[model samples]
Target: MPDKPAGMRFKVRNENKNALGGLATRKQITIYFTQAVDAPSMEVLLYLPNHVSGPVPAFAGLNFSGNQSVHPDKGIFMSDRWINNNQKGIQRNRATEASRGSQASRWPVETLLKNGFALVTAYYGDLEPDHADGWQTGIRTSLQQELNLAPDQWGAIGAWAWGMSRIMDYLETEKRINSKQVALTGLSRIGKAAVWAGANDARFALVVSNESGEGGAALARRNYGETIAQLNRSFPHWFSPAYKNYNQAPDKLPVDQHQLLALIAPRPLYVCSAAEDQWADPQGEFLSAVHAGPVYQLYGKTGLGTAQMPAIEKPVGETIGYHIRTGKHDINLYDWQQHLAFAQKHFRKKAKPKT
Candidate 1:
């Protein structure tokens, strides 16, 4: 969105994948920016389904921690970058052995590979650490003045969303990956980034926002939970400075979250929320999806179609899907199950045919 990266190239991939027991392969791909030659390069942790033949669709997401934290595979490279000190297994802002697979439950790797899908993820810290001053060590400060905005320009969310596009750039070049079926996904703040990425880039075939509150799928006009004012006060660096202008007056804003969802249009979009995560306003998110249905109808596609939120754990919709699961605000296996089903239905993707 803030102009494509100068260039993106992978350093290493598909090496030593046999160790995964033939079921799958994990490779670490480092992406370097030609424009910001000196900034820290982003690392992509990719898992290709060896069980599938030919190119396969993939899910590219930005993780909360380092790649090593996603899975316990000892082969996964530990991030050498700075991370939130409070994160489990992170010692002195660096990931350690104990950090491996700490968040594995959040990712259903085995199930995904069995279903014939590839998973691509990188630590959000790769582009810029999730802190106020993170720009100094990220591509944000390394890039030209245009990218590093003052008050009205894209901020961390914009940069991270741009990174998702860059990942798509690399995916387009890989024969083993079906670039046309790729889905961009994220949870919480990262989920917000995923939605924004989908709005700005059309390369992504699908998008998933898991409890991406406020600036995400949740309707800002409702002002039900996680109001705009609170979001800005808590995480000032997450959105464009221009967004803050309406922090206290969401109704005054010309557009709302539904417009953002509409941007994905006839393309498949899934909005998820949790019953207990009131801070994300599950109801508001459902309404946004409901309102976005008209836009989808313009293309002869379906949306949530209902003003009422579905029963907890009951997901509903076609082109635009939504669900409020019975849990707190976190991406779990259930969330993946819904998104996978949504992607499979919209993309017409099925398990790889038996040889």
Candidate 2:
């Protein structure tokens, strides 16, 4: 992983007032590694609680569509970045006002603000778009020499994970945000990025995976839904070129995803799944957490306390939280509610003084 950039700062393009009816303040920030205008930059949308007495806990993650699509705020700077053509409210591969707040249901900004948690999100495309050719326009090429990965090294997910670290750099500058309490969260493929980010950067404090099966928290050896062969075939750029060798041969690999979860030992990790999202292998998701228990035990911390999956909609586990909601393959209010509850539990523990 790249060392945290020194002298990193963000420029406040505009501050939107009366956001969520005065419950929070919104800002669109353009972040840079240095003062050079031509250098690569990332745009992040921040929603900070107005009623909190001190620095608030926060969620830092990547958005699927665009920053503008997270909320229907006319004040939000329409993202000039490339977007998927099939995305709602987008036309000509660019964001339009019509696409505003289209994914707001997944975000639940008001709940975060009401519960005294700040939320910051950036368009994943800002780092690297999802297509095979996306790296040509995003930060991948610009960071090639900087990253210096081998031919077998994967840049796609790593690039997006690196972007999350950049977001952490920006969060450290915000006085109203308790950077130490920040949780990195994501859904689907981005959830895979979230785990990779948390594993590499301990500064994340907390990591939440919402239905990030397969290449994410799920064990490839399980031979469950969404096989390794399918992932590389469907999303060829998501993994390293060498990973293709493991296709249909997960057992031949030296390790399974339980080892990946072990990397987050002693820190809080939450694995979420949906009952109906069979393709994501909800059971395999729970089992990975169960198998990772030994690592957490080494630190005198807890992993998922049981090998058996919890009843649907009944969240379980201690430092390692796991849940399977009775729904489809999507992020919903139920998922956020459990995350807020889990964050409050672990983060509050850290806030306490020890004897």
Candidate 3:
């Protein structure tokens, strides 16, 4: 593992057994920096399969809505934290009871539990909200003050990625989780964060991106859909101020998404897209994975060998995986199934047997 970043601390706020009808156990963890007593803290929800005998592999990621939205359990905290007001079940930056379990279909908690994997999630808003001024209300503000970082040093995506790393740090201490086998995953913008987190932290055994185009797994030079100009204009806070300079000419940028994928070389990475989600540039994402093949080859590992994208629902690759499923811009059981299968292929040998 890489050298641990400085000044991080974790505390388990609460834990309960027989959560979700005895299907799993749940723990609420708090992560903060030790340098500043007033530093912003983040809340993470961890669910472990109840029937599993020993430490199990887990999937960790940031969620778009409140933690309660992932499952119907009322025990899950309802986020009063800042969030994109546009999301369902959210109004005026707060989550309503109606929003609970709104995203359950996409999470597939039951399937994960049945398959003997743990699920760890945190609301992205707990790191930073999805607006330009969101930094003022989230971890970025405290981190900037504590670390003495300049405003342009990082952005919302970086903060979210850092939150994921903090979660991993806490997982390393858990006796019921195989921290080394934990996979990082997310959808759309959060998916971009997952890739960035995996790129920066080698602790993650697998990384999965679901329709994370443009600044994610898709080549910015392709300019197929959601160009730099549009993204910078629509979501200026997503990247650093320096990133805006490339809006008019992406080719001039020093790096592209292919290089981002290459950063995760030798580690299993999966990039998924939807057929109707052209705004994510499905072809561009596949091409980036293809371009990253040589880097994997440097480690004596195979990447997605085909220059062409595969048929709908047909996932391809060894160390690198890509697929454009038959649907729109949303994660469903199909995407999760592929991710679970990929994790099984790479982690099964190291996984502890279930009692």
Model 2, span 150-242: residue lDDT tens: 423665788889899999988888888898999999999999999999999998899999999998999899989999999999888888788
> Candidate 1, residues 133-219: lDDT per residue as tens digits?
777767677764535454335578877888898888889887889999999999999999999999989889999999999899999
The alpha-carbon lDDT assigned to residue 2 of candidate 1 equals 71
lDDT of each: 0.85, 0.86, 0.87
Give TM-scores for every candidate, taking all chains together and pairing residue i with residue i: 0.95, 0.95, 0.95
Instruction: Report per-prediction Cα RMSD to one decimal.
Output: 2.4, 3.4, 2.6
Clashes of 1: 0
Which candidate leads the pack in lDDT?
3
How many angstroms is residue 336 displaced in model 1 relative to the true structure, after the best TM-score fit?
0.8
Clashing pairs in model 2? 71-101
Model 2 spans with C-alpha error above 4 angstroms: 4-8, 150-152, 349-355
| Evaluation by lDDT, superior candidate among 2 and 3 | 3
- Model 2 misses residue 143 by how many Å? 1.8
